[model samples]
Target: MNYKRLLFCLFTGFTVATSPAFAFQELQPSDDYIQVSKEIVEILEGTHYNKPSINDQISELAFEDYLDALDPTKSFFLQNDINALSVYKKRFDDAIKSGDTQVAYTIYNLYLKRVEERLTDLENNLSAMLEGFDYTLDESLDLDSEHYTWAKNKQEQDETWRKRLKNRALTLKLNGETPEAISEVLTSRFKNQLKRIHQTDAVDVYQIFVNSITAALDPHSSYFAPRASETFNINMSLSLEGIGAVLQMEDDYTKVVRLIPGGPASAKGELSPNDKIVGVAQEGKEMINVVGMRLDDVVDMIRGERGTTVTLEIIPSKGTGQTSKRIKIVREKVKLEDQSAKKEIVEVTRGDDTYKVGVIELPTFYSDFAAQQAGDKNYKSSTKDTKKLIEELRKEGIVALILDLRNNGGGSLQEANSLTGLFIPSGPTVQIQDQNGRITPLGDRDPKIAYSGPLAVLTNRMSASASEIVAGALQDYGRALILGGQTFGKGTVQALQEVDKGQLKITQAKFYRVSGETTQHKGVVPDIIFPSVFDTEKVGESSLDRPLPWDKIHETRYPIYWDMPSLFPILEPRHQARMAKDPDFIALNDQIAEFRENEDKYKTLSLNENTRIQINEETEKRELDRENARRAALGLEAIESVDDIEPTDKLVYSKEAAEILLDFIAINQLAEREKAQQEQAN
Candidate 1:
């Protein structure tokens, strides 16, 4: 597993990337809140519905995802209860349709009342229990096998995490590092972590209880206390006045999952991913121990005035038993641009001809929903910018297009559909199903097909949602051949419905191909499945906390004009043959395997100079292998020896998979030939 996959497999204490545990068992929801939230849901389902407005639906879906995040076994209430209680959903829909929560407050009040009741119940029930209950149950669930492996609750999650750190700390301590140096890193985090539990255990319990009731309704609706619900909105595009980084609660430490590189924390150059912070302080002040404080409270301190400096004392998590040290940095504002798509070109040569293939690396399918809603033509999205890029590439006479969507966590549905339309004739793009089991067809609005020649989609275990839509549609219509690992299996569509004070992000429907097969759990199987360096078990929906199961529907009849067979037969063999001689590909596989073997070696590291020298030597050797592999792949000459290295300030190679440019060039030759034949006949 690469860093991304390892980061996922181990979660924060096995957090699985950007989220804390979603499913916690033994929840006792506020019955009254459930009753009211249910009533509101019913109202939104009926007369209050207006095609599920964006902001409203976002609020709802966000709330829903949070609710689902609470159930440990992903079994909140009994299945029978869900079936029987679904009757009130339409009432909630009606209330939503009544326009604005103020007017619809009647239905909102119902949901609110239930939430309030649940809160009262939690206050009463938890008072009796005191320490809170462990919610994870050992039930067999095949939905997401990974969930079963997650550490349950804060206690389980934190204790296991603390031990891991403690073990690493002991390793460092034994290495002869001063106790004060090690203390500078782990001791504060440990104490702060404990203090957090002592203070906010009740908050987590309340979150669990409320989420339980909301999750039972559907994975979308829930009650939010003022702070948490606010945080949820920020997670789902809540324009909050703070640094833009998604922090996950790990035992007692909050781990930085997705860092907006241009944002305050990332830009501060003080904090980096996998770097654990033990002490945080404002400028000119003494560093404070925040170890045992609740994540939210820590967050409150971390997030503050724009341009104001807050120092974060951190230890980089390069590997385990690596000496944990301290460094401090300031915070600033992080915007979406820090995580958007970038464009470049890859040169491929087959036989005597060279083809310049334009590659668009979309890290994520992000859109300025706020700007678009306000009718801002200046709003940013993948469709608009990529269109501009295509025109530029066309001017350069590029032979083909490679859309790279690996590791994209998906974004706006509207933009994803629009993006697909850029490649195909305007038509229905994806189909969605609601809670009522009614299917709604979403389509491409534009009629123009952008570039129609040879196109290839690059994906992996991380490409998801909107990215999946583009790849799946292209595959279904024969517009493009998908290459690399399987795309992320997030075919479910979520809508956030805004409530009075919070929102519910609910899994309103599942997506279907032009052929009506949903990519939910199965993801998009590539036309060419590469021997991915990725450990499939370690990423995508499989790695999520409470992801839904894979399902399918009757097929749709949308047809394509391209022949998939001609390309596949030749393309597959050519790719396989290329990899055989590809030294870079070979080295990558070896590197991945070796890392897996030594994944736990960090614990054995001693701070002794000899041990440190050995580790650094190994790191350098691995880097040398990687650099040599990259040098060979890019048509560059190989190093004469391991020591004959190209000097660089940093690691030159990125973890992204190299596109099969050779296969694409070969495929294009076939396509160009077909086009010529049609012209001659005409």
Candidate 2:
């Protein structure tokens, strides 16, 4: 199961559904699911800022489009299936709109068997339109012109894909192998492991083809057989136990991109970003070969409950192109608390007096709904925890506080408002408008202003949504000096409604600042811009094949920087002078150069007998060097190794860079403090 070939089939497009080994009934529908889902929808629809007509249109159309794409015969309804589908749609919509995903879950399975029947007949009865073999555009779809080219490419890719899938299906039947057994073989084959093992690579290829074809339809619409669908449900609920790593299909071998801090993977100490998973088995059981298996099937074999041990045969990203090493890991639920506000005391000495700057790292404004809904007073909320941390920082006699919002992808809106209230004197946090041209402002009436001391808000390209709200509010009211790279331009506010609850998350509206500015394409420009490593200026929706336009409204005035003298311009030159000689910044440029040179590093894997197995053991060293150089050039400390630089899997973007970039804000903090102190004396 060559992962590269699997990747090819996936990108090319191939798909199907199969019955599961075990027919597990879904969990009973719960009212709580409905409450949570509808609440989310309501909050989104009640945009307190601008006319979110565009968001509304996209969500509604996407929902219909996704459903139609999934089962055109049912959603579009032929004469025979029309009446039945119409009734089902009514009931389905009723279930979906009720805000109870649990109810929709039941409806989904009710239709699952029906879907299976259609899939079985697809090979025999599908017309050219259904086959999608014809390259002609579906005039009825009236698709974008660019997508026409995408379709042409898809058709070409699909042709190659069908051959692979057909070959796999025929091979599987001739061999008389079970799907799960085939799955294990496929998984194992991905990492090149089917020799002594009792399986072939065809199994893994089938699953990848099925998934890729389904995914080509939309971001959320996955083509999962019953087993994979079951796996999907577990993920949507956000409650799973394993070495909590977000896996990615990098070419063929599934790679670990992020480790969930509280999970076994993070605790294991051996795992890191870019490590590839090759095989899995239960402790005491013969390790199952899983190298090139389909992601869902492989995941099914690995994931288990808490305290349970699962063995992972990992082929690490670097080090001795070794044989798949088996490592046993215990699984655990992801504790949101582990990802809560963390405080670090940054020691800074400008002269004789050293400043203990309390740096608060906020990953996101997260709030655990299930725990909070249960009347847990100590429930996790960013504002509440941050407010608590501010008091603690004050207790330590901190000279300044840095609110680290880099890579914070935002969380609870209420928390964002509450966080804003800590700075702004209980005014509106942001405004939202609906399609009907109605404006609604989300006001913060709480009079609790938390830390009013000298503050510097650190931001970067990944600081988005609630991060923007907090940063924007603080910047408006002269409370904190903003620093770091530009904020991530994610001004659009999304409301996850019951569209299918966990089936699909929908974007319902765009939020706007009180001044009527929607943080859409344009991110918040910090008072002073530092040279950030992630220059995603060209990587946003604005750069998409077809995306919305960037527009603005009347500017809302806040109480911050407006009245402050030219602090940004003044500090810019001084910081520039220092950055010019910074060793760390120079090192960063070196790393970037090396990275550019060997980016084709993966591309050059020689399948030639001797060259392939001798993959370099020096990759970790090289990677560490690259990171060290880049960080150094940025005026940061030279990282001794990758151990010195933690890959911020939890942060929204590259916030690890933001953590080190915190030093650059020292100038901004000083300027603000001096101004405030001089004003007090005057």
Candidate 3:
């Protein structure tokens, strides 16, 4: 994660290198780096959950990871360059263990040389290349790097780059830029990229090399340089500042990975995971193109004092980067009250009976650690607030309850256990298995049930970590019906250790459900799946690289509250029928399908100007058509294209969950009445 965008809260918040060979001084590993490298190896091998060995296999994987990190698009290095670097391919393990970073440094220095060469080539021929493109030609460019191999030679690389440059022009032209503006933007970006490359320091190179080795073992483990370590500490302590987003460098773009629950972006609900930020502007300033910019530099530009606004030119996660939208967020402290549990009452009428359904939206499982340690009895915590909210909901005459954990990317494990206890009797809520293969069950020791009425838990692909623990626990105990999309599978525990100069966040343990199923790669699956806009392939823990594998251990002892399976038959059919015909749901499904089709088509983009124009127009038309269709179905007035669409306050998923909870209540009522009749007859 980029330190600049590390936290929407107070704290949260990548780079490159090279050489006198390209009029830039090459970075050499300092004495600190050598000692730190050895320390990292010792810690990872001695205490990491996987107990990874520093062997040839790990070295080979690190080599690939390092290369990909440097040039993910494979545009900078040639096949021959890679061939030359292969000698160090299997030497990284020994290098790290022996405190020798020459292998990593050599590879990075060469990569920097290639970057300088490519940018220089672009700079030298920009005018001729810009004038030379024939948009009428039926050519296409493959954007997926995995589909490409290293260019055989400079000519092959030039041809690939020529098409790329043309595509860049075409993209900007389609976005309404003039020929002069496009030329200026392209020239400035190329120059800026080269300038930033020259600015790369030893810390940048060291962080990349160490991370490559750590990430080779598992996606969750990583090394943070001194600067990044400071940002990480701030994130753990502060909850106010910036826009509350975690950003990473993907190719040339800074991508939003996660939006902090209480941050402005999450609250605003416009910025989403996987959205690529292409440009940024301060309030009342011109938008600065950020393509090929360093992650920290971009962050520096985006961060501001509280109450100030920063606008981002975002290529939406759902779009194929051809179209973009701007979002403006006010920088502010992410207050605990803002993230606190909130309750709502939804009234659902079936035939004649009106049922009041309680809805609690928990953004994150948070606790005030400072206050708690200070013996503050009323210290802010998710469980305590939720318990109070439930009491308030019960007072409002609600008969059923729904806990909405949508987009809750887990927080404190203690909160997860205590929160789960609010609905079930004392029992193990989650199990942790460490490197020693010993299982430790962490559960709610309290015997009190906060709200035991007909219950349903709503989750989505972004519901992760602590969220998964709570959802999985309730589901295993048959205490609630899990609804919505599959939860984010992030059940691994990470602990930060201070190395010689920086910090290392390493995976230390794994989380399992009371049912013995590990929630690492395969998050908690909902009992009633809902139509989701999130693409499984693009979101969730399973989508990450080298995620810990899913396995099971012995099940923990816990009493079931209900025979949930028996009720699924009645609920599943009703849900399917309702969602299939529901106007909002139908529209959602159509939009997702359209987005997916665009994704497939965007794998390789047409170079023909007319074809691209036609495609963009058709996409907008389809989007407008779907919007009008949905409006007409709901008997609302329809307006013009794209511009006419407005954000609605309606909670579509929550409404559906209310309907499901109503059905659950009805089922239980019928069972009770039948039992009474039988008893009377007997």
The TM-score leader among the candidates is 3
lDDT of 3 by residue, 428-479 (tens): 9999999999899998889998988989999999999999999999999999
- In the range 1-682, model 1's lDDT, one tens digit per residue, is 2343353234323233453322122122233343444444554444221233324434444344333333223222233323333333333233333322221222222223333333233334432332231112221112222333334343454443333444444444544656556555454444444344334333354444335434444333455655787787676663454665666554335666445534565444445444555557877875675643556787888887776777765555533334444444454555677666667776655579776777777766778887989999998887888888888888887777878776666877888889899898888778887656788878886778787877878877767788888888888888887877887787776666655435555566688887778888789998877655455654556655445667777666676867776667776776667666665556655666666676555434342444555666677677676777778677787675544654221111111122354555555677799999999999
Query: All candidates' TM-scores?
Result: 0.66, 0.58, 0.95
Candidate 3 lDDT score relative to the true structure: 0.86
> Can you give the lDDT of residue 455 in candidate 2?
72
The weakest ten consecutive residues by lDDT in model 3 span 5-14
Candidates in descending TM-score order: 3, 1, 2
- Overall local distance difference test of candidate 1: 0.57
Tell me which of candidates 2 and 3 scores higher on TM-score.
Answer: 3
